[model samples]
Target: MCLLLNLFHLDLETLEQSNVDGPYEPMEADATNREHETEQGGTRFSDFIPLDFEEEEAVEEAIRRSLEEETVQVPQESRSIKTLTTEEITGIVKAHSEMVVTEGFRSIIVSRRNVWTSAIRQFRRPRFVESTDMLYVTFASDKNSTEDAEDLGGPRREFFRLLVKAIFQESGAFEESPNGFIPRLSVSHVQNRVYRTIGQMMSTIIVQGGECPALLSSVVLDYLLTGRMFDIRVSPEDVADLELRDSLKTIDQATTDDDLQRAIESCESWRYQIEGLPNPVTMDNKDAFVKNAIIFHVLLQRKSCYDQLAEGLECYELLPLLKENLPLRVLLEMPKVRSDLTADVVATLLKPSYSVLGSNKRPKEELMVVKFRDFLNSVQEREVEECLHGRTLTEAEKTFLRTLNPGHILAFVTGSSRVPAVGFQPSPKLSFVHNENKYLPVAHTCSNELEIFVNSKNLADNDEFEYNFLVALMNGANFSAV
Candidate 1:
C-alpha cells in the first residue's frame, strides 16, 4: 500500500516532458474504430491494438527489461521513504489531531469600535461554506465588504493557526486531520484535551521535582489562564498537589515579613516530602494534600516564625474534612485525657463529633445540641436512632447536619442519654450496627439535611460537602479582615 502511494506521486508533467520517442501512433478516430471492433470488455486505458510479429517481440523484450529494472529499484526507494513505527505513529496522532469547525455554512459580520471614541466602524466579515463548496469561491462583494472580508481572512487564518497549535499542545500531537488518533475533534474536545494534558504534565513535573522555576511558573500561568483546573474530570489529588506547589511559590515570592509569617504559620507537617515516607502517609488523600500543603508552607521558614501561626490552629477543626473515617485512627493515636475526651477531641479538633446518648438527660434535646455542634464543627453525621424511631428530618435540619461532617453516622437510641464513645475504632460489627440504623427517621433527617446543603452550595458532583464547607471556612478565615 505504501509503495503504491509513493509510486502514485510520479510527476505527470515531467513524464509528458520526457524525450522518449516510439513508433507513430494512429489517429484517435482510427484507434476508437479498432477499439470498438475488438471490444474485449476492458478499460480504455488497458486496451491494446494488434502489432506485427517483429514489433510485438521488441515490445515484450522491452517490457521484460523494464520489469527486471523496477524489481531492483523499488526496494531501495521503499527503504528510503522514512517509515514510522506503529508506536511512533500512534504517539504522533495521539498528540496532534483535533476536530475544528473548519468549514460550515454560516455567515457573520463582526464590527469593532474605538474605546476612546463612541464611533462604531465595520471590522471583519466571516462566512462559512459547506465542505463540498468549490475551493476559492469568490465573495460577491461591495467595496466595503470586499475590504472587510480580505482584512478578516488574514486574522481568521492566523487565529486558526494559533488554535491549531494550542490544540496540538493539548492533544500532544501535531496533525489536525480528523483521521488522526485523538478522539473528539471539536472545540470542546480541544479544550478538554489541552486541560487534561496540562494537568498531567504539571503533575509529572511536580513528581519528578527539581524542575526549573520558570517552567513551573509557565505551567501555573497556563492553568490560571485556561481556568481548566476547575473542570469536572480534574483529579482532586492533582488540584491539591498543584495548589500546594503554587502556594509554596506564592510564599517564596512573599516580599513582606508579615506575608512570610502568614505563609510559615499556614504550613503544616503534612506537606513535607521526606525521603522514604511511610505507606499510609504516602497514599493519595485530599486531606493529606491539604495537610502537606500546610506543612510545606510552615517548614519553608524559620522555627521562630511558627509562633505567629497560632491563627492556623482554627483549621484543626477541619480535620474531619481531610479524612472521612470517624473517629479517625490518627486521632485515637493522639494522647487523650479521658475516654469521653475522644468525643470532645473529635468535636473540638475535628469538624464533626459523634455522641451516642443514653435514654435519659433529654436525649432528643441533647442530640440536637450535639447535631448542631457537628454542623458548626463541619462534621455531618446522620442519627441512626432517629431513623429507627420512624421520624423524618426537615431540610433545615438536614442542612444543619451537613455543616458538621459528611458520610458520618450518629447511632442514637430513642431514650439513650449517655452517648457512647467509640474512639476511631474500625470494626465490621460496628459497620453492621451503623447500617442497621441508617434508615431511622433521625438518619433520614440528617441525610436529607446534607443533601439540601449540598444542593444549595452548588458544589461539584464529586465534591464532598464536608470538604467544600471546610474549604469555604478556611478561605473565609484566611481572607477575613480583622
Candidate 2:
C-alpha cells in the first residue's frame, strides 16, 4: 500500500503547477458522475483505509518496550505517571527509524494540523472524488476546468508532502500497513489530542470556576482553530441516521437550539415527548431548553440537579454557549502560545531529564521542585523558593535576585518534574522575588514542549477554580486605583 501510494503519487513539484483554483461551481457532468458513484455503492474517502489491517497487540507491546528501553528519570517524589501523547510517540518512532530528523521534518510530525487526511484524498482522486476538509480550497478556474480535471490548491498539495514525511518517520508502519496497520493513525492521534484539549478547557470552566468571557474566548478559539469539532459533527446527510443520532445522544455537545432538539429527538420516542412538554421551541425558549438539555445530557435522570442548574442559569445566566461567537472568531487569528515557552519552563525544573538506572546526583545538584502555581502567586517581582527550604545561595546569586524588577510580571507555570529535596520539617510559607527578569539566574526553563510539567491534571477541581478566582480578584483590585 505504501509503495503504491509512493509510486502512483505525483511529485510535489507537479502538484504545485497543476492549477485548480476556481469558484465552487463544479461541472454538471462531474456532479452527475459523483451522484452515480454514490448510487453504485462507491466507498467515501472518510471510510477508506489503505489496507484492511488492524494493528496487532504485539506491535503495541513492541512499541511500548522500545519506549521503555529509552531512559527516563524518576522524580524524587512519587507521582502518577503521565500518559505519552501521540506527538511524543512520533519522536520515539523517528528515533527508532535511525533518521536524522531535520527541523522541517520535525515540524510536520508535531503539527496538530490535518496533514494526512487532506493529502490522501487528492492522491486517490477520481475513485476518492470526495473532498477532505481544507480552509481555502482552490477550485479549478472555471474557464480551464473541464469534466476531465479539477485542481487542488498549493497548500493542499504541500500537506501531502508532509504526510509522506510523517509516514516515513513511522517507517515500520509502511510495512505493517499490508498486515494491519492503520495508515490514518496520525490523524486519529491528533483528533484525540483535540478532544482532550476540549475536555481540559471545559474542565477549567466547571471545576476551576473560570466562567468569565476570557476563558470562554480561549476555549472557543482553540476549538475553532483545531478543527476537531468535526469528530462530533452530525452532517446533514447523517442527521436522520440512527448511528449519528445515537452519537449526538451520547455526546450531547449541541451548539444551538436546533442541535439540542435533534439530540432529544434522537433518543428513543419517549424522550421526544418531554422536550416540548415544558415549552415549545422558540427564540425566547431555546436558551431555556438548552440549559435543560445540558442538564439532561449530564444528569440524565437527576431531576433535582436539573432544577438546581435551571435556578442558577435563570438568576446569573451562566449557561455554557456551545456555539461560535465573535470573541472566538477574533481570537482565532491571534498567535498560539509558543510550545518553546512551556519547554523552557520545564527544562529549568528538571535537572537530569532522563538517566540510566542507579545513577547518582551531586549533593548540591539535586533540584528543588516548587509548584509553579504557588511561585507565581508568592512573588512580587520574582521569587527564589530555594531559599525557603535552606538552600543557601552565594553572594552573586543573591545580588542577581535583588536586581529583579517589581514591575515585570514574573511568569510561572503549573506542574513540575519530581526532584530530590532536603529534609525540612516546617510549616509552608510564601515568598517572592522581584518581578523583573533582570534577576533571573541560571539557564533552562521549558524543556519538554509537548508535555506540560503538570503536578495535577485535574484543572477543574475546586482548589484550582478558587485559585483562579482569587487571582482575578487581586488583579482587578490592583487596577482599581483612585
Candidate 3:
C-alpha cells in the first residue's frame, strides 16, 4: 500500500504552470461520458477501506460486550460501608436524583468549553460505567444545525483530550513527580468531594472510550489498588517542600562526617517533622533518619489526600479493571505518559474511502487521497530540502508541511493531540468533499472522518488545495490552547 502511495507525488513546479487553477469548465460531452461510465461501473478504487454499516455495527457490538465484561463485581463481604451522617446522606441522595434524570439518554453531550463540568455531571450518573452507550461530543459550530448527527468518534476523542488536560493542571488534585502525577491534599476540594468527581471522570473515559489517565505515580497507583504502600522509593525530587527536599538531598550527598553532621543539624531545625529520628543522630543512624523523613513527608504527610483519591477511584469500581488489565494498569503509572506520535503511525491509522471505480468523482477523489498520502510521507520522512524524494515543493508548501506536526493532523481528525492509550477505536476515514466549490477540508470528529476537496484537475492544481487544507486546519483545529 505504501509503495502504491509513493507513486503519487506533488511537483510544485508543474502545479504552478497548470491551467486547472482557472475556473473549472467541464465539457458537457465529457461529463455525460463520465456519468455513463460510472453507471456502467467501469472501474473502482477497491483498495480504500470504507467503514460500511456492517463493520460499524460490529465495532459497536464488540465495544458493548467489552463494557459488560470489564465492569468489576465486588464481593459484598469485601465492600466497605460507611454510616453517613444526615447531611452526607441527604447530599448523596440529592446528587443521585440529579444523575437519574440523564439515565434515559443513550449518550452524554459535552462541548469543548464545558468538558470538565459535563464530564463530572454525566460520569456521576449510576449507569455511566455499567451502561454500554457511547460518548458523544458536540461542537460550538453545531448550534444552528437541526440534525441527529453528532459524535461518531472524533468529538468523543476531542472531549477526552480536553477533559484530561483540564484534570491534570498544576492547581488540580494531582502534582507532577519523577514517577508521574501523585495526588495532593487540597482541603477545600476534598471537602467538596472533588476527588470523587475526578475519579468518576477517569473511570468513565477509560470504560467508555479506552482513554487512560496515563499520568499517575506507580507507587500511588499500587497503593490505590492494594491499600498498602509497597516498595516506596521517594527521592529528594519527590519532596514538594523545597527546604525539606534540599535537606534530604544534602543528607544523601554528604560524603564526610562533617558534611553529614551539617545536613543533619539543618534537619534538626525541623525536628518535630522527623517522625522517628533518634535525638542527636550520629553517622550510624543517619540513613535511617533520612529514610524516615522521606516516608513521613511523601507518604505519611499526604496519606489522607491519597486516601480520598482512592475513595473516589474505588467508588466507580475502577480498581478491579486496573487489577485485571495488567498492561493498562501499567500504562497508568508509566513515567513517559504519551506515545511518540510519528508520521507513519498517523498515516497507518487513516483509512480512505473512495467512490465507485467508474464514477466521475472517483478520479479526483483518488488523486486527493494520493496527495494526502504524499503529505503524510513528506512529514514522516522529514524532507527538509525543497525536493521530497524526487518531487519538488515550493517554499510556501514546504513551510506549510513543516508547520503541521503529526499530532496536529491526528487531533484534527481524531480530536486528541496525543494518541489515546488504547489507540483510535475506528480508524479515521478519508473522504472527499461533495461540493467542488468548497476548496477547504472539513473534519467530522465524531465519525473520525476528514473530508477533502477533490475538484483539482490533477496533481498540478494542489497548491490551492494545500492552502485551503491549511486554512481549515488552523481554523478548525483549535486544540493548542487546551
Candidate 4:
C-alpha cells in the first residue's frame, strides 16, 4: 500500500510538471496500475489520491497571475539599441556615390554667358573692339582646348565640348589656350567684327532698301556731343540728306578693325569727358542750363534721359529749382524726401494762407500766395490733383499716416478740400479749427441744442470756420442754444 501510494504521488507530480493537456487521464491510468500492483501483493490503494477542486482552482489562478505579470513587464535586453560613429556614417555616404553629378559646371557656364551679354549690351554700341577681339580669341582658345579634351574621353568631356561651343556661338567670341597660355576675348570686338561681316555680305541691301548710314552717324554724333542718342522722332529726311549720308558713309567705310579700335577709344574718351563735366545741376549750384535741358528732354519724352537729368538735379542746393525741375513723381520718389516732408509740402501748397518763410515774412506770404495760385491753376488745368487723389496712397503715405496719427486726417481734409479753406488752426483763432472739447459727449440737452444751432447758423464769415464748426459738433462737442 505504501509503494502504490508513492507511485501514485510520483505520477501526479509528473502530470503537474509536464505540459500535456490530459494530465488528469494520465494520472488516473498511473493510479489504476498502482492499484493493480497493490491488489496483487499489498495493502489498499485508496491511500494514493488525486487533488481536490480547491487545490486545482488555486493552481490555475496562480498560473493566470504569473502570465499577467510576465505580460506587464518587458525584458531589459530587448530594449537596448546600437549607435553608429562618424566614420561609419561617412562610409555609408561614400557607398552611395551615384548622387553627385557635373550639372553644376553647365549652370555656371550659362550664368557667365548671361552676365557677359548683359554687360556688352549695356554700351548700346560696341565701344571696346580690342576687348571684344580678345573675347573672340578666348572663345577660339576654349574651343580648341575642348576639342583636345575630347580626345581624352571621360564622363564630363563630351558635355564640356558642347558647352564651350554653345557659349562661343552665343557670345560670338572664342577662347584659346596655346602652349599653356590662356587668352580671353572681349564681346565688343566680336560684335564689331560680326557687324562688319554682315555689312560686307549684303552691301547691296544696305545701299538699296536699308535706312541710310547717316541715321546711325547722327546717333553716334548725338551720343558723342550730348551723351544722348537721337530721339525716336527723327524724320527720314534727317538721315537721307545727301551731305549727311555721304559723311556717314565715309565713317561707315572706315569700319575696319583698326578704325573700329580707334573709334572705341574715342567713344571711351567722350564718356570720360561727360562723367568729368562739373554737374551744374547739383545741390551747390542749380544750373539753369541743366534745368532747361531737363525740361527739353521731358518735352521730348525721353524718359531715360529725363530720369538721368532728374538724378543729377537732385544734388542742387536751390529748393525752388529742385521743386520746379523735378517731376512730382520723381520728387515724391526721392529717398531723402520722405512722406512727412511730402505731406507737409503738399499740405502747405494746398492751404491758401500758409507761407514758406525765407527771412522776409511780408513779401514771402505774397510770393507764396502767387506761387500757390499759379500751382493751383496749373494743377487744375492738368487735373493733376484729381488724378493724384484718385490714386492709392503709397507705402510712404501709410507710414506717414501711422506716425502722424490723427494729424494726417486733418491735413488730408485741409489739402483736398474744394472751395479752399483757410489755414488749419489748433484753436478757434483761425477760421477753421480743431476742437478737442467737441470730441467729448455733451452733458445737458440745451448744450446739445446750442451745438446744433451753432452748426446750423453759419455766423462766421469764413466758410471753413462754419464747416469746421459743423465737423466739431458732429464729433460730440457740448453746446447750448443760448
Best by lDDT: 3
* Cα-based lDDT for every prediction: 0.24, 0.26, 0.54, 0.24
Considering summed lDDT, which 10 consecutive residues are worst modelled in model 1? 116-125
Residue-level lDDT of model 4, residues 231-303, one tens digit each, is 3222212332233333323333454555534433432322223232233223232223223322222222222
What would the per-residue lDDT of candidate 2 be over residues 1-482, giving only the tens digit for each residue? 22432332233223323423311222355335435534543221111101001133332342333223222211212124343332342333223222321122111111213333333333223221222122222323335542221212222222222333333232111111111111111222222222222222222222111111111112223323232322222222222223533444443456676766665564444335343323555445544454444323322322222222222222111222212112212111111221111222222322233323454422112221233334333333244434233444456445544532211111111111111011001111122222222212221111211111222221222233223322332332211100
Of 1 and 2, the candidate ranking higher by TM-score:
2
Question: Which residue segments of model 2 deviate by more than 4 Å?
Answer: 1-482
Give the alpha carbon lDDT tens digit for every residue of 298-403 in model 3: 6655665665566566533555655543333532454332333456545555666889889988887777777776666655565423333344556765566665
Per-residue accuracy of model 1 over 277-379 as CA lDDT, tens digit each: 2223222333344343333222211111121111121121212211222211111111111111113322322222223455332343333334434443334
How far residue 287's Cα lies from its native spot in candidate 2, in Å, is 11
Between candidates 2 and 3, the one scoring higher on lDDT is 3
- Kindly provide the TM-score of model 4 when superposed on the true structure, using C-alpha atoms: 0.14
Model 3 local distance difference test score: 0.54
Tell me the RMSD of model 1 versus the true structure: 36.1
Instruction: Mark the 10 consecutive residues where model 2 has the least summed lDDT.
Output: 415-424
Report the number of the highest-TM-score candidate: 3
